[model samples]
Target: MSKRVLDVGNCGPDFSSIKAFLTKNFDCTLDQAHGMEDSLAALREGNFDLVLINRKLDRDYSDGIEILREIKADAVLKDIPVMLITNHAEHQDAAMELGAKRGFGKLEFGNPETLEKLQPILG
Candidate 1:
């Protein structure tokens, strides 16, 4: 079966590349949830192998650390791998400390936030 990815950024050109790449490279199914709460709710109700979280969100919420904390705190969702996509490598240490599988800079993803490096983690 195709692996499931919870993309928390919704639909946008900025994220379109990653979405397209995920399908093209991994042949995975992506379920896009627009907000923090929605993504959290989905995690509670369903099972997802990984989560690709964008640096920003629909609202003014760009804080992925707290969300990462909450996810790790949850018994059911703690094991789900979470990857943070950002333009700053500075967040790498902090995010990893909070249980994020990894953090990537916008440039790291090149034209998209999807990278082959994600294969092992998501696989």
Candidate 2:
């Protein structure tokens, strides 16, 4: 079975890396929704094992935190792992408490240790 990964990104290189990583590690298929509305629409129609949300959106839209809350509130999507990937360090603890499996900063995005850190949760 193919696991699905969703990226709520603003057309960045991060999406490419994430797609590559999941393809290499989990043989997963990736689909991305660019912003708040797109992400929500994608959630309604697709099934994902993991989700990556950028903390800040490109335009004036709902931030990752609000998206996190919406995902958790949905009975069907609540169990799927949602990760907040950001440059901000301050949101880590709050994200963990808000039902994200983990919060990863941009600096660590491609680090060797990053995959190791995610192994326990994503493996």
Candidate 3:
């Protein structure tokens, strides 16, 4: 089955890596969100299989965490699997504590670990 993914953050190499990986492996569509507002709008407007939020967005890194919290708290959005993307382990823990499905390290985007970590969500 096809899937929908909402990718929230600035356009960067990490985003590229993720897009490439998803395109090559899954029959999915991507909706890009450049900031928290856009991310929230996308979540409300569409049903996504997964959400990938950057540890930091166009304005600030901490904004992503706030976005994560909002997603988890929303009755409708809470069901979507959310992953926080960052290279920092500390940030990952914070995201997890906020109810993120998983913390994804941007550095691991091109590695096999990315695929492994994404398996459950993708499946």
Candidate 4:
């Protein structure tokens, strides 16, 4: 069976690339959430093996961090692997402290390095 990924943030070109790469290389289904409400709704609806949270939503980077905290605080969803994607590497430490599996730069998506880093989580 294919794993499911909840991509919470912009579902535009950036997410499209990540989705295309992941679907083509890995056996997984990727769904998107435009913002916090949509993300919460999606989480309530089904199970997701992983969550890809972008640093910016429609507004700013803080929204993603807020959603990340919510997911970590929830008993039901806390166990899911959450990865924070941002342009700055500085966000990595904060994301990890909030229970994220890892934080990767937006530029890393669709590349072999990111793919390799995702192996353990995907497995």
State the displacement of the C-alpha of residue 33, model 4, in Å, after optimal TM-score superposition. 0.3
TM-score of 1: 0.84
Per-residue lDDT for 1-123 in model 3, tens only?
A: 889999888466667778887878778878798887788899999889999988778556556888899899999889888988888888888888888866667567677777787778775
Q: Cα lDDT of all candidates, in order?
A: 0.74, 0.76, 0.81, 0.83
Q: For model 4, how big is the CA root-mean-square deviation?
A: 1.7
Against the true structure, whose TM-score is highest?
4
lDDT of 4 at 52: 91
Q: Which ten residues in a row have the lowest lDDT in candidate 2?
A: 56-65
Steric overlap count per candidate: 0, 0, 1, 0
List where candidate 2 sits over 4 angstroms from the true fold: 120-122
Candidate 2 on 1-123: residue-level lDDT in tens?
Answer: 667778886455767876776677765788987776788788888877788887876456557788888888889878888888786767866778889876677677567777776665456
Best by lDDT: 4
What TM-score does model 4 achieve against the real structure? 0.90
Q: Between candidates 2 and 4, which one is better according to lDDT? A: 4
Candidate 4 local Cα displacement, residue 103, angstroms: 2.7
Model 2: lDDT equals 0.76
RMSD of each: 2.5, 2.2, 1.7, 1.7
Clashing pairs in 2: none
The lDDT, on a scale of 0 to 1, for candidate 3 is 0.81
Poorly placed runs, candidate 3 (over 4 Å) = 59-62
